[model samples]
Target: MFKRILSALSGKKSRTSTPVSSVHADASPPSDESELITVYDSYGREMKITRNEWRDNVLLPNLQQKWSDADELYSLIISGLNDGFVADLIPAAAQLVAIDSNPERSHVIQGIVLLENGQLDAAETTLRAGMAKVGATGTLLTNLAKVFTERGEQALADETLWRAVQTEPNLENGMLWWAAIQRERAGEEGYLQALRTVAALPGSWRAQLWRARHYLEHNDVEPARALYAEVLAGGRFDGGALMMISGDLGNNGQIPLIIELIGPVYDEHKHDAMAGINLLRAYQELGNADEGQALLARLYALGFMPIKSQLDQFAQVFEQMRKQDVQGVPIDPESLKFTTLALNQPIWHYGLRNADWFFAQKPEGASQVGFFAFSKSTDGAEHAESQREDELGRLSRAIPLYLAEAVHYWSDHVGTCYIQIVEGGGPVLSGAEADGQALFDIVPPMMKYFVTGEIGCSGEDDQVQWQIALSLWDCATRTKSATESGSAVKADLGALVLDLETRLLAGVGLGREAPLDSFYLRPTAEVLPVYLTELGQSFMLTLLANGHVPKSSMWGERAMLDWPLNMALHWPTLEVAKLMYICGLGKALDYQSDVLAEYKERSLQMLRELEQARSPALRLAPLVWKVFGMQAELHAYIRELPADTSPEHKAWLDRVSES
Candidate 1:
């Protein structure tokens, strides 16, 4: 398994596919045009207005009737395909031989799609036919050249693209694409032509962005900055140009420059939740939870509660420090007890953005019987109708790929083990229904026969069967609450823990023939510690569970290798009280007050701290609060027992909090 898989896909509009021309056609105006037509207005952002409004504004009444010029008709249709009256968009893409909508460009898209799909002969056939019709139209020839290059005919691909630019002097995407290829083949001359292409299209944002991307990719910072400034000045904020650039900078670990570039934009557009999240990411990488918290506070003040998974992690970093360094709690990593022997971090878990694993260590060294999941995502944004289909398609393909990787890494495992699922196919800020079924689809036999009803949704409420624990949180970006109505999984970890205990006691997670709490299951018999981290922050759950953890569990391979390994990395400096509350709840999850348990005194200390907790870092579905209530009930349960029968009852009551 691997942490993150950033495939080096073509990230450009024209680069990804050969070239595309969307389909649209002129139509007679309807009598009662109530619903408006939506089209891409300026910068790929949709703009909507009624057809009559378009006529009233641009054509002025009879222009729709008078628009009979074939050249104008084709131009309007093609432009509308790019802007409004848009017909369709594809996921991955459909290879085109010849679509009737726009045969010239459609043929190009078809040929490129064929080439990409490894149908070299089919693609060549499609491209040749298109060239015959369009006569060196940039789309056809450039793609033909690509096929040529793929077939070891590099000179032909280059010559064909050159012919494209020579014939269609002002073909924008073609020139950009041609220039890109030329830089390698034509060297300085190609670069000069790219510059000329940019100049030719004065006031074109796409052209500038393409050029800016070239500069940024090559580390030509100054020119990139100038182009970025002009794009920003053009008021394309809503168009997502800056956010796209921010993604590039953030991914490359350029935090400081991102802060500088987007600070003014963020200030001006405080209402943009996506922009705020981008800045929050920068601050998180900087390990400035105080500023990060401040940013969250502003969003709260604006009445927008962005999903705070990142914030929750940011707060956890500071919390762990306070308990160990400031409170003199003498926190020891050795306190954790694992049911299994060891854990192994495979290659797949390396660079994940948000990933978590639940493990059961075998008696053997460096082996874990657990599921580690890290998601691989493809943005399904701006294509609402097609997203659900595309999301499933990508996931279906990814599942087997991960299984293959697991087979290679986890060769020693006996049966089917481990599951990874993708989350949030698009930006969480987009307010789409975030998918969670994949998490539940672990293994039906495991869920139905054993851990049924352990998480929340039972067999009917959720059809998934695997012993995996999953709760889907639907985050509402524009609202005050981070969660709208969520699925049936327990919102708190304690409840989840109790459920897991019941399942293990019933021999749920153990493989089919294994008895109750087998080595395979490694049930957290009494206490189990839980951890959560995203970007810069991490949460530690100090709950009671069952297991015989090796001494090396404190630090080993496949261990907490990031922040917990280097606490000094991006040291958090915000609220510490909230983390104490999490610690309290974590302790409560691990609470062992059943007459003979030794951690009752520590549990009481966690409860006392919970009362004074007043931080907003975890207001979004605060699980710690639930832990407090459960701890109280736990204390009451032990108290109700007769002191005469309880083991060492007197010493337990008078016990002091462990330093």
Candidate 2:
């Protein structure tokens, strides 16, 4: 039944379209189509092979399908350049000459490739022809200036660069180029003079924004606010831009200015989460209790699942502030423990969409089995000072999620994880204080059975001992149904989980089987630990994308974004891992996340592979493709997909498009 549902839903076409512009250009493909690949060839040196070999081995196999896809093709070129496989990109860039849309960008890409391949004359002609047809976009002009500089025409380059900035004062590359030139010729004074000139340009909010930063730096609040208001008036700024402005004010000790400039207009729906954080900080620092509590309540209502920890922490601070004001009680904010909010909420990949539908379809005899986070049991001893302690905390949450996914995949039952939030901003590793009765009080009505456990580790670094005790609770009878416990070395964690999973499945009467049509597959021992970590990271990123948590909070954890793609690329045959990868990439792309910028090429390559294999991940591929500036391809791809029958799947696809 579930397979039939997926089949129906996966076939639905999207109800949107994106237009592609037409541009005509006359240019021939590269004359030397060498099959023999090497680093030196695109660097103006050669290792030769016949045209037939090149066509069969390289062009047809790699570059042919992506010819018209500017984003995919350029991603390939850039990735190849970064990895020293430039020779492979010559044909890719050659395809750019014939692209219809993004003519200016296409020309820039081709010119850069030409310049890199030592075709100075060809590069110059290409840039000039592009300018004639496309009317000189800042990016096009900037690259054309580079070609001039490469040809030792310093005067022409200088003239072209100046024109580039005047033509598009907001282009970072062009503005940076002009700034560097002025600074070299003069100094800091000249840079400021050039910035002022550009800031005066009509419709140049970026320049105005930069000037505002400068004013704030010099403690000139009025000028900064005026400039910021002008930028806001342009209405071209996005949430990210507002966040940047807020960051500048916050960093410059202009906290009140942040609220003054942004408070009136700030909407959680329209502004980045960081802007709210700034306002909250301002209210808290000023002891504005009513306003602080109001803002905190708004943020909490967002229900960002992954940032449960961070939001809980925020709640604790605000709660403390409220307590001190009303009760006149001295509460050390640090002494606050459990969150008063975001309690008992289960972490599911797809948010509450179709939740009723899910439980409604459960088999008559089957039961809802929830797996809550394992408590960190210290047994009253001084907690071991192991570096792996953090790892254990993450696993406590991750293990439950993994187990829940497994249960749902292998049986006709509801499986979900309850990783409650702690006051200090991390998963609530519930110990004795958050006991069974306490947990049972918070579960939803459909949950008839639940699992809980305690986990701890000893020793440090490479030598660690891990222990976990698990119990199954019958919500109907309000009794412990079964129990399982195990101890293992850090290297043997997978073996331990597998053993526990087997017993838990048996205890609940679930039979494990691999279904060919199901998206879920049992993760292997080799992949489980790494995949668990990825799951936790994926959850974090998904929350971040939803605007529930500040991006700054996850700065040190970028591996959460990169590792899924890396792991999927490494273990291509693992369908389970690929699911996580697609989910992670979709969240990152949907949110315009910068964390995945470094892995763009890898992600593109993975997408291509998934496309070819017709992987299940293709169901969610539209979300990933749209934000990579591949709107045309995104529209075309969506039109080809059939309507998905699964409400969960359809909701995700629709939500990304709507967002």
Candidate 3:
């Protein structure tokens, strides 16, 4: 059988009738207080909507006598009826019948609404009338079968279903119903017989697929494979077809066949998640680690978060397999080379201004400072120390962003992080290890100062310690101008970074006390590393979204975004924290992560806090609402912005509004 039955029906449990509890449920439309209406499927897919969405989408168009609208109202009609909108849907169904654009569909929905409302006689009469007017359609006859079944006339129900499938063997529900009856009358043999009967029809792709699945279930390989190929070559060969074939085959322990059948036809860009997942699992089970890794990359690029856990598991397994093959190997020198490099690219933040804007606003002749990420010390002494590659990898990017933001906030100079692009695509850490002369030549010509460093860890376990040594090079003078160093036990790395930030500020000749109303809050020691982690991840996700970084270059747990978003609410005054949170949200929404709805209420709660603030960051509230597709709230907030807002912020707001 197919993994999911295709039907234009409401409840998955019973397409023919909704429960009595649902029938008597409240039908009042949601008010503004209930900002979103969430609808979920049995498969765990969720859709967000507004209360009047049905009215706006279905009722109003039908009311305007738009005939074209009537043809497509079947799906919404199902939703409306399921949500206990029988009172409203009754009239809408009548309108569809009158529109006559798609008579069979309109009449079937009307019949289903009546049947669900317990008006069986009216339902039967309407269905009969529809058949008389438009001739027999599979859907209409299917409903008539339900009416017969409701009255306990099993014989009539079977006959009606048989006729329905005969009329349209491609109708999945009818074939399913007929085949079930056959199975009950006899057994597996009877079921196969029924499926074979339908499969014999000229355009019976669904029937052939059902029969093929039956064969696969019984371990009848040749027949199933032949039927599958025939169904695939038929006109209905598509993602859904492939998903069913692959899913059934996988369920029967035919892993290799999943790859053979699905790998060639699967379109990562257009196919559904299940097909890609089946193929990915096949690769993993068959130990095709490279293909598994590549497929995992493509799946992640799809940005659908519902299957994130599965993708992450495959990623971890693939990485482990890859590591197993390279545990003691030396680094590949060729992997370090790259082209098309640039610096000072803008990282996404909700309220923060862009780099170009900052460049234009800075004072003339202001020293342009560039901070490169500190690379791990490769010396034998450091190699013997306790170190985690993951932590080091994160810190390599985070530290430079922290230092550059510190300089921008504390001094008048225009400071920015300098990241070297990796060959395939990623921020390169080893580039920071280059000598002063090499760094001077690689950095932007406009940058007058460069801050580079090396981080080393020593000791072991609980006694582990971290050390950082930073040098400030005055490129104009072609010499090192100042140097600073700091060390702390592992737990106090944040404190180490704080001390270095203070010293680095002084080294660059701006060591004044922090402003009482500073624009950026110096994160507490506990929050420093986590906030920096969030900042680094935000930059990478932003790059991935903008196509600056390939999806294949990404690795690590999705908590890279999750933990940072959760921590953002704690650091309200830290602009980087807020930016990190928003950029994380942008990626989640862009990828259609399930977390978006999970976080929507929280986003709105944050918007309430943002609304009371006077900072330019307050404008981010509308974008948050916009990203959630909350049109009413977004427009209302846009109208309420202060009339004297700066042109730059206003222009940004206008673009967000229009977009």
Tens digits of lDDT, candidate 1, 147-200: 787789877767886676665544555566666666887797777666566546
Q: What's model 3's TM-score? A: 0.64
Q: Write the per-residue lDDT of candidate 2 for residues 393-499, one digit (tens) a residue.
A: 78877787777776776655667676655333434445542467776788777787889888889987757888889989888888888889998887888888888
Look at candidate 2 and tell me the lDDT of residue 237.
71
TM-score winner between 1 and 3, please give it: 3
Give all TM-scores, in the order shown.
0.30, 0.49, 0.64
Candidate 1 segments exceeding 4 Å error:
1-109, 116-141, 148-177, 185-193, 202-222, 235-244, 247-256, 260-280, 286-659
Candidate 3: pairs in clash: none
Which candidate order results from sorting by TM-score in descending order?
3, 2, 1
lDDT of candidate 3 at residue 138, scale 0 to 100: 80
**Which is the leading candidate under TM-score?**
3
Give the Cα lDDT of each candidate: 0.38, 0.63, 0.66
The ten-residue window of minimal lDDT in model 3 covers: 1-10
